[model samples]
Target: MSSTTRAARPVPACPIRPGEPCTLCQVDVTGPQDCGLVWLVMGDDELRAGVHRSRLAAPGRR
Candidate 1:
């Protein structure tokens, strides 16, 4: 008998939250494109600013 395995594809980083991988944080979301959180954050300047601040605080800036 022969068996084969396939490697898992790497998840792309969250565009709304820079420098962060898509962790499937939202149960309803399959990816950033359909994520409600991403939509909400992006729609609000304050919330989007917060995400930007977090990315800037990380060790290596994007």
Candidate 2:
């Protein structure tokens, strides 16, 4: 008999939720415009949208 194994999915290093602020936002970047995290998040449409929605829902942002 043969058995098959499924590959494990990759997880993000940061603990923040999809709609929450990313690690980049939590830190001080020397070049905010060139933030790698921003690029990474933007690569995923759902995640990027969630982040934007979260930012808009944040307190005092209104």
Candidate 3:
């Protein structure tokens, strides 16, 4: 019998938070929609879903 181990998938961090500071805020913006983090999260379905779920879970969201 042979045993095999599967590698774990990488999970992206959430991009935005209702109250916490964002990565874009720490740097200067060259354009209106120039945030790299936003671009990354928006482009990825998993990351975008994570961000959406977080927003819904935030306090006073209901």
- In candidate 2, what are the lDDT values of residues 1-62, reduced to their tens digit? 99999998543333224333334554565333556676677778898888768767767653
Give lDDT tens digits, candidate 3, residues 1-62: 99999998543332566445443453675422666767877799998898789888988763
Reference-based lDDT, each prediction: 0.86, 0.57, 0.63
Best by lDDT: 1
| Reference-based TM-score, model 3 | 0.54
TM-score of 1: 0.69
Local error of candidate 2 at residue 19 (angstroms): 13
TM-score list, all predictions: 0.69, 0.45, 0.54
Order of candidate numbers by lDDT, starting with the best: 1, 3, 2
Worst 10 residues of 3 by lDDT: 10-19
For every candidate, C-alpha RMSD to the true structure in Å: 2.3, 12.2, 12.7
Better-scoring candidate (lDDT), 1 or 2? 1
Q: Which residue pairs collide in model 2, if any?
A: none
Error of 2 at 62 (Å): 5.7
Off by over 4 Å in 1: 1-8
What is the C-alpha RMSD, rounded to one decimal, of candidate 2?
A: 12.2
